[model samples]
Target: MGNVQLSLALSGYDHTRDLVEGRVATPGIDLVAIQLSIEEIFYRVAKFRDFDVAEFSFAKYVAMKDQDVNDITAIPVFPSRAFRQSSIYIRAGSPLRSPEDLREKRVGVPEWAQTASVWTRSWLHHEVGVRIQEIDWVQAGVSSPGRQEKVPLKIPVGVNYSSAPDRSLTEMLLDGTLDAVLSAHPPEPFKRGTGEIVQLFGDGGREEEAAYYQTTGLYPLMHVVTIKQDVLDAHPWVAGNLLAAFDRSKQNSLDRLADLNASRFPVPWLRDHLKDVERLFGGDPFPYGVEANRATVGKFLQFSYEQGVAARQLEVDDLFAPQTLSAYTL
Candidate 1:
């Protein structure tokens, strides 16, 4: 039989470069990689089922499974992961001292079920001692107005929640209507360095994020690679093939990222930064697999459930394709 030609929509991520660029090929598969913004890919895949395989929001993936939509099955490959503490921004010169100070203050979220918001709130409640219900949560776009929750939510009772349909989160924050904004992207004012918004964790939150990792051991995950259930059913071998190819692809990027001799990526002090990352992660900066990330997965799902991002707490076993979950022997 010829290779399974499939449409794969994903954000342009360095880690998945090899797979997308044909350097690392998935066995028995002819992947047509569609590069787009993460938001666009996610919305198209979730709303329209536009691709055979796609990068999907981790929160939305879990929520889909929780709600029993069951159209897509994931592999253990996480294409996007980041420490989100730096995403929380407060108006410059605000009296808010720390995340704990967010208690009872209005906080804006791009979406209640946004994966970044989930991880940020988890860190706030679990590490910073700020409970979810103590903060008044407003849903709005970061730069534009009228952003809606892409995934339906069963908002937990007693959680102060509302919406700002006509204004952006950064707008509300600047207007004093919101004390802070927890967003995946820095507010436009913050990006422009207008002295209007500042991250609660300072500069890039590297120090604060390092502390968060020390406490939680979680380099929080944001996106997962998913294949349509119909595609998987028709080609049961696709899951394992994609998983192996993705790992190789990640290694390819890591090799380039850690290159000390020549500049593969355009980052100054790349070697120094790589050494720091290696030291922090104990040499395994980004391991891709269900078992390798069990604790992180559990913590994320637990937070997802508590925050109503997912309908219920989902197990690691329940989240991925069975073929990718464990090793098989001849």
Candidate 2:
């Protein structure tokens, strides 16, 4: 029989290029990989389930799962993960020097259920002692107007939250309507290098972010690869096949990054940074599988419920497909 043809969609990333380009092939499947902006992929999947497999926001995935929406099941192939401390932005010389100073201050988020904002709020609530309810939370587009939350939220009582669909978060922060902004993407003024806005921490919050990693051992998972439940139900082995292929694709990128012999990436000091990352993050900075990411997975769910991103608290075992959770013994 011919290989099962599966349509897959995800953002363009170095790790996923191998799979998209057919350098890494799913054992029993042929992937018609479609590369789109992460937002576009999410919109299609949420509204239409447009592809058989696609990248999903970890926050949205769990939110739907917690509500018993099982049309799609995620595998352990995390395509996007990043330290979110650098995502917090404030006007230059703001009085809010620390996260604790955010108490009672207005903070803008692109969306309440945004994966990056979820992680950033976790840090603020858990690490900085600023309970989420203490701050005034405003939702809007980061760079454009009218961005809206992808999922419904069961927000807690006493939490000050509102929406500004006509104005962007970047504009509010610049115009002083908001004290700060938390975003996965940098604000327009920051990108423009106009000196009007700056990250809450200097140098992408590297010193503090490294400290956060050391203390929490959390790299902050932002995205996951998901397949339709019906697809998985029909071909159980497809889960393992796709997982293995994604793992290989990621490793290919890692190999290229670590190979300083050629300029595989245009990043300056790439060789020096590779050595440093290897030393700090070990060989697999981006490890796949549920067992490898248990802490991060569990932690995200804990706060996902606390913050109302998840309708209910989710168990660690409840998320990924069972086939990808374990493998046959050697």
Checking candidate 2 for backbone clashes, the offending pairs are: none
- Give the runs in model 1 whose Cα sits over 4 Å from its true position: 328-330
lDDT of each: 0.89, 0.91
lDDT of each residue in 84-133, candidate 2, tens digit only: 88999999988878777889999999989989999999999988789999
| TM-score for all models, in order of appearance | 0.96, 0.97
Stretches of model 2 off by over 4 angstroms after superposition: none
* Candidate 1: tens digits of C-alpha lDDT, residues 106-209: 99999988899999999888888899999999999989998888888999988989888999988889999999899897898989989888888666688899
The ten-residue window of minimal lDDT in model 1 covers 198-207
RMSD of 1: 1.4
For residue 192, model 1's alpha carbon misses the true position, in angstroms, by 2.1
